[model samples]
Target: MNEWERLRHAMRATERPDAVLDLATVMREGRRLRTRRRVAGAGAATLAAGIAAVVVLVAVDASGSGGTAPTERPPPVAVAPPSVGVSPTSPEPTPPPTVARDVPPPKALGQVIDSGVRYGTDQRVYYLVRVSVPGAPKVTVGLAAGRRSPNGYLTTDLLVNDVEGADRSAGFHQIGYDERSSTTPVPTFGYFVGPAQRIIGTVDGQQVDARLARWSFDKNVVIFWFDPAELAPGKRLDGIIARDASGRRL
Candidate 1:
């Protein structure tokens, strides 16, 4: 058992009091919550791949040719703004030695934006993505999934949303997950970007030519994305978004 669980178990073993029983219940609930989150992570990755395939086929058919096409994108709904923050550097790890590097970064004018879709059957599941547009100002992106509770799904809340292009100067924005903010006992993992290698990233089904801004562990799950213009062969995706610069500029 984990440390938290161990403490609860010890308390229950000694005291017959109702408080001890209550602590045990809390411990069980914590375990259940953690398990649910882990399940969500694995599910999101798999769903992302399936969603990617759907996007690619549609993108190819929409354009005369299969080549990545630049077009109008959907708009983002006006959000009070999830705690969006930029990173001083890309969030992905550096590339391997074998990978070649180009001195001049390629242009990312027209990244294809992924159309809005319910990634999974759950009504609360949705993703917001920004296309890797060439020469576009750094824009913010968000993804929100509703919380599942015994009371049924609570109103869709901002599960995770962070900016991908802020420098060290920019303050950290609210990432929405707070329990993990205080500790690191939980098993955590994330991606990183190394020097000399292009920070290549795949979104849903599209190969985006953007670099990472700030991908980090929000609880055990990590939230990560890249700048639309910074990515090579940038293809911007179109979506209906509020306060989206991709619509205004690129």
Candidate 2:
């Protein structure tokens, strides 16, 4: 208002308004004002654009450094151990078969025979040949192949199964072959001939007398010894007869 009023007053007081008014100077001032306004607007727009560019750059840098990209790597995968294979074991080998020895044929009474006996046991078989004499109390004679002794001797025994006889307490009457005594020679043959308690019999039509004696090992068993030469193969005593000590026929 001051500038406009002053200007109007100066214009009215002018002696030659047309001449006082400097058209060229007025035109130049108007141009200068327009230039100053244009310059001010350009400076404001430049400042605003610079500020927006700075904010955008700052956001871009922040996102690049800390927003999406991962700082730490993922954890490593764990590895497992390999599986072990098992092998099958074979069964143990079968044991070998055992062989059994053959038993000889029985040649006489008390001789051993084969009854399918095997080793590793106390098993045996013998021939059964017996004689029975008649008496008030019967007397029976039997034979058996005894067990082998630890000294490696096999003995044959003749026994009276029923009654006891003279030797009550004593050792063996004789040992045919003593394994303990190396100097004692083996006898070729032994004989047992006697009037044994008057017990007599007939064998092969010959009047054969028996020597009745009790076993030293078992005093209860009465016995009679026989010569192997007198017993032929496949021949046994027939028509047997006997008499006891008290003259009792048996």
Best by TM-score: 2
The TM-score obtained by model 1 is 0.18
- Model 2 clashes, total count: 0
Best by lDDT: 2
The per-model lDDT (C-alpha) reads: 0.31, 0.34
Show where candidate 1 strays beyond 4 Å. 1-21, 64-250
Could you tell me every candidate's TM-score relative to the true structure? 0.18, 0.24
Off by over 4 Å in 2: 1-142, 146-152, 155-196, 216-220
lDDT of model 1 at residue 55? Answer: 80
lDDT of 2 by residue, 124-220 (tens): 2222234343431222233333323334343332221223221221111111211222222111111122222333334545544433343333323
Predicted candidate 1 versus true structure: per-residue lDDT over 114-169, tens digit per residue: 21222243232222333232332232333332322334343333323333442111
